[model samples]
Target chain A: MKAYLKKYGIRLLIVVFLVVGILAVGRSVRDGGAGLLSNVSGAIRTPFQKVATAVVSRMEELYGYVYKYDNLVQENERLRAQLADLENQIRANDQAMEENARLRELLNLQQKHTDYTFESAKVVSWNASNWDSSFTISKGSDSGLEKGDSVVTEYGVLVGTITEVGTSWSTVETVVDLDTNIGVLVGNEQVSGILEGDYTLMRSQYMKLSFVAETGQIITGDIVITSGAGGAYPQGLILGTVSSVHTEAAGQVEYAVVEPFTKLDELTQIFVIKDYQVVE
Target chain B: MFADVIDFKKLRLALVYILCLAVMMFFQDTVFARLGLFGVKMLFIPAACVAVSLFEGGFRGGLFGLLAGLLCDLSFPESTFLFTLLFPAIGFISGLAAEFWISHSFTAYMATAGFALLVTALCQMVRVIIVEPGSALTCLLTALVQTLWSLPMAAVSYTVIKRISRWGNKR
Candidate 1:
C-alpha cells in the first residue's frame, strides 16, 4: 500500500490543488475582491496610471473641443433650417387666413343661394395605417352627422363623405379611396366627368371625362367641381385642378389628373352640409 | 545550477498559474464567444485549476483556481457575486480529490479529468439554479457540454504540469 501510494502521491497532490483553487477563486470573486484588487493595483500603479490618464484625457479634451466646434456649426445649420420652416409656416398661415376671409364672403353668397344648414367640425385624428386613410371628426351623430353626409371645408370644397357615424366621433372616407365615385363637372365649361378613386395609387385618383369629345376644348388648370348630378353632394362644390389632359387613341374620350387643392394630410376643419335634401 | 537549490519550482508554477489566469480573464469573453460549440463554452479556468492541482500540491492548486475564477468574474461585465463563492468551492472540492485520491497512472489522469468535469458541472448547475431557476433544461445541456469540452484541456494541462513537476523533482 505504501509503494502504491508513493507512486500516486503526485497525482493525488494535483487533485487536491484543483479543488482548493476553485474554492479560493470562487470566494474571492463573490466578496468584491475585484474592487479590492483594483484599489490595490491602483495604489501601486497610480503615478503611471495617472500620467497615462492625464495624457489621454488631454488628447480627449482636444478631440472634444473639435467635436464642440462641429456641434456649434451643426446647431447653426439647424437654427437656419428651423427659421426657414417657421417662415414657410407663417406664410402658409397668412394665406390660410386670407382664404378663410374669402370663404366667409362666399358663405354669405352661398346663404343667399341655398337654404342649407352647416355644422363646423374639427378634425381630431387620422388613421395611423395606410390601409385606412379615413380621418375622425369631433362632431358625430350627436352633431347631426349621419352616413352619406357630404363633408367639405369652409370654402364649399368637397373633401369626402361621412362613411361611419358614432355618438361622439365620425369617420370620413376621402374621395381618394377606391370605393368613392362622384359625378363632377369642369367649372363653367359644363364638361361632365366621373371622378373615381384608384386604390393602386394612394395619393390621387382618376377623373375620367369618358364622353367628352376629342375636340372638347379642355385646357390645363381647369377647375373641376361636383356636378350635383347624383344628388350625393351639392352642386358647384370645388373638387380639384386639372393637372393633365389626354385624348384616347380612339379619339372619343379624354381624362385628366386633378390634383386636389387641399392636402388630405393637412385637413384640420370642415363643415357638414346638413340641409341639402337628397333628390331621391 | 546552484541557484536551483532554492527550489524555485513551486514559485515558478505559481507564477505560471497566475499568468494563465490573467490571460484567461482578459480574453474570456472573446474566447467564450468564438469557441462556443453547440451553445457550450469551455470552462478553461476549471481545466487550468485541475492542471495546477495535479502538478502542484492541493493548497496552491486550489488557490490558483480560486484566483483565476475571481479574476474572470471581475473582468466580466455582467458578473454576479455568486461566482466568487461558487468557483472557489469547486476548486476546494477538486483540490481535495487531487490531494487524497489521485494515482500516478493513465487511469489516474482519466479519473482526474472526470472529477474535474464533474466539479465544473456542479458549480455551473449551482450558478444556474441561483441566477435562472426555471431554465433547468438549458442549464443542464450547457453544463454537460462544457464539462465534456473541458476534459481534453484538463488532460493536456495535467500532462504539462506533471512534466514540469518531474523536471522540478529532478533538480
Candidate 2:
C-alpha cells in the first residue's frame, strides 16, 4: 500500500501540475488571442519584427529577379505571387480606411441629428441570391434594434429598413428589393407618391416612384424625401433623386425613376435609427 | 542512433496535408472571400477536401475532410455537424473513385473534384431547402457557382501534391 501510494502520489502531483500549467496557458491564450495579440506582439517584437520583415522583403525582392534572364518563368511566378499578396494587402487597408472614414461621418451625423437615437452595425454576410435583396448586419436585438427600424448611411441617405432582428444579427432589406415601398415626396414641392422597388428598375440601381398624379409636374433631378406617413418612417429622410419622368405607354399613372443616394452594393457599415421624432 | 534514422514517410505525408489545408483555409476565408464575383465568393474548403481525397486515398481523405468541415462549421455555425458529416463521406467516396477507376493525374483529379464538389453542393442545396425554404433557388445557384469556381483549385492542388510527393520520393 505504501509503495503504491508513493508511486501514485508523485504521479498525481505531476499530473496536477501539468493540468494547472495547461489551464494557465489556455486561459492566457483565450484572453489574449484576439485584439491584444497584435499590440502585445508589437510591444515585444516591434524592433526585431521590423528587421526580420525588412530582411524577408529584401530576400523576396532578390528572389524575384534572381535569374531574370535564364529563369524567366520562375521569376514571373514569384513576381506574380508577390503582386497578388501586395494587392490583397492594399485592398484590406483600403477597406479599413474607408470604414474608418465612414465611422467618422456617422459620428458627425450622430452629433447633428440630436433627436435620432442610433445603433451602428457592420454588414457581415450577404444573401447568396441575386433575385432577393437583404444583407446581414453584425448587431441585432441585443443592441436594441428591432424590426422596422430605419437604416441610413452617414450622409442621411435612406439605405434600407431592418426587416429581421435576432440576438446578434439583423437583416436589412434595401430599397431595390421587390418587397420595399416607402411613402415619398418629390422635389421641394412635396408632390406625394410611393417609392416602390421594381425588379426591372433594380437592375439599373434605381427604384420607381409610382402613383403620381397624371397631371403632377415631375422632372428630372427632382429630390425625393420620405413622407413619413402612418408613423412607419421618420419624416424627410432623403430617398433619392428623380432620374427620369415617364408614364407607362399603356397605363394611366405617371411614375419617375429614382436613383438612390446610397449605393447598396458598396455598403459596409450602417446606422439604425432606433428612435426618432414621428413628424407627420 | 541506428533507429534515429527511422522512417518519416508518414510524417512527411501528414506535414504535406497540414501545410496544404492551412494555405487553403487562408485563401478560403481571407483572399477568396474578398474576391467577390457577382457578389458571391468562391468556396475553397470543398475543393481542397476533394483534391485531398483524390491524392491521399480513403482514410486520409476522410481525416482531411473532417478538418475542412470543422473549419467551415466555425464560420457558418447554424448546421454544426452538417459539413463535418458531409465532407468526410464525400472524401471517402472520392477516395474509392480514385482507387478504382482513376489514375493519380491532374485530369483525373479535376474530374473527381468536380464530382465530389457537385455532391457537396447538392447536399448544401438540400440543407438550404430544409432550413431556409425561401432561399432554395438562390442556394442552387450558389452551389453551382461554388463548383464552377473550384475547378481551377483542383488543378492547383493536384500540382502542389504532386510536387510534394516528388520531393518526398527524392529524399
Q: What's the TM-score of every candidate structure?
A: 0.39, 0.51
Candidate 2 segments whose C-alpha is farther than 4 A from its true place: A1-113, A120-149, A161-235, A242-249, A252-258, A265-269, A277-280, B1-26, B36-40, B56-93, B115-150, B160-171
lDDT of model 1, residue B85: 60
- Regions of model 1 farther than 4 Å from truth: A1-106, A204-215, A277-280, B1-171
lDDT of 2: 0.77
**In angstroms, how far off is A85's CA in candidate 2?**
23
Error of 1 at A64 (Å): 40
DockQ of predicted candidate 1: 0.01
State the lDDT of candidate 1 residue by residue for B79-112, as single tens digits. Answer: 3454566566556665677678766564666666
Best by TM-score: 2
Model 1, B131: alpha-carbon shift in Å?
58
lDDT: which candidate is best?
2
lDDT of 1 by residue, A1-280 (tens): 8888888986899888997887678767778555555678888899998999999999999999898988989999999999999999999999789668756955874685476677778787654222224667899888888898888876677888888788998878876654567888774667887776543333233333334534455667888888788787888788888777776687544566676767876787878877775544
Name the best candidate (by DockQ). 2
